[model samples]
Target: MAMPFFNNMLALLGAIGFWPSVVYFPVEMTIARLNIKKRSLKWLGLESLNFICFLLTLASASAAVRQITQALGQYKPFMYKA
Candidate 1:
């Protein structure tokens, strides 16, 4: 159970933490402190970057889910194959 859930848990952690800490907060803070205009090129770029990061996160989570599902059928507890 725990073994199968490891990847899912990792995906959840990254989705929850990576965006806010790595992209969202820093980008928003930079915009706010610099007074970037709403529709300006720089603002658009930053927002786009944020969106890209979000997509990456989504893709990773989906991949993890896919991997777990595929492995689940063959999963055997404490049965090591050399």
Candidate 2:
């Protein structure tokens, strides 16, 4: 159903290399003429930073989701006293 498709898209977006691939576009274009080694190094550094940012964002989002879910799940039975 639509839920599964949406979940799959999220998972794909959250994959480790996804953001780097998106962020690397400008770097790739700029360095298209560089020697192989230099280009590789530049890409490696850019990708590393991109990935780190992506991971931090993902972690924060996950923590927020967890907190929201925990708060939603909290309940007291004292009203019923059973």
Candidate 3:
């Protein structure tokens, strides 16, 4: 009973964690591009670094949810001997 609930909760968490990057990355890149004065290599490097960090965070959250779900699925309830 609780297993399904936990799986659903994990799925929801993963979705929540993933969506912001999907929506924010393009907007962030656009803003960064627009604000750059001269398109220097330094500014491009910083933007790429920021995007990489965001990708790492999103990947970590997704992997965590996957691991937790798999762990939960393997759990067995202990039965008492009468």
List clashing residue pairs in candidate 1: none
List lDDT for all candidates, in order: 0.82, 0.55, 0.63
lDDT of 2 by residue, 1-82 (tens): 2232344335445554444565556555655656436547776886577567677757755655565455446534333423
- Which candidate would rank higher by lDDT, 1 or 3? 1
What stretches of model 3 exceed 4 Å from their correct place? 1-38, 77-82
Of the two candidates 1 and 2, the one with more favorable TM-score, higher being better, is 1
lDDT of 3 at 37: 49
Task: Give the TM-score (vs. native) of candidate 3.
Answer: 0.46
| Strongest candidate by lDDT | 1
The 10-residue segment with the lowest total lDDT in model 3: 1-10
TM-score per prediction, in order, is 0.76, 0.44, 0.46
- Residue-pair clashes per candidate: 0, 0, 0
Give the per-residue lDDT of model 3 (tens digit) for 1-82.
Answer: 4453476466657656654566456646765777864457766665676666667767777776777777677666763335
Per-residue CA lDDT of model 1 for 2-76, tens digit only, reads 585676667767776777799888999999999999999999999999899988878877777777687777888
